[model samples]
Target: MTFPSPKAEAPAQRFQEATAAARTALEQLVAQANEAGWGTEEISVALLEAARFLNEANRKDPDPADDPAISDTPAKEQIGHGELYD
Candidate 1:
């Protein structure tokens, strides 16, 4: 394994610390929102949008059209009955 240089190390550590602090801040904000009566649906949708934003920001590949790893096959759907019926 390779170690980061002295100059690069501080910035990397700072980034790591910032992300950790942000996670705690987000948790507290979500809890406050919940206590302030934001419904599950609203909170969930907001979080989902945040996730999509993060994915878009960090994605390396903008297109997967020619990517061989992606399957062209149609998805197989599973039908389920109630627990008692099953």
Candidate 2:
């Protein structure tokens, strides 16, 4: 009996396309910032922050397109609404 060929599911493919778009946008932003006289240190910091934010967001709900090599990790504990405003 022949086994089915492994292939990326539709949701996963869409996720990958979205991620690629985001990365391209980020590169464009960096180029614009550089042309605006933003120093490397400042740009690097902003990019790092953006990466951190994305990481946190991904941890909450990982993209279905993520490679199978990426192991799933437990999501961080969400703060209560009241606690957030406190």
TM per candidate comes to 0.38, 0.42
Off by over 4 Å in 1: 1-9, 39-41, 44-86
Model 1 per-residue lDDT tens digits across residues 1-86: 22233333588887876676666666776787899999757886898799898788669666755565423432332124332223
State each candidate's clash count.
0, 0
The superposed Cα distance between candidate 1 and the true structure at residue 68, in angstroms, equals 47
Q: What is the lDDT of candidate 2?
A: 0.68
Model 2, range 1-86, lDDT digits (tens) per residue? 22233245698886776677666776777788899999767997989998999899899869847554322422232234333223
Candidate 2 error regions (>4 Å): 1-9, 54-86
TM match of model 2 to true structure:
0.42
Residue 61 Cα positional deviation in candidate 2, in Å, after optimal superposition: 12
For this target, which candidate reaches the highest lDDT against the unseen true structure?
Answer: 2
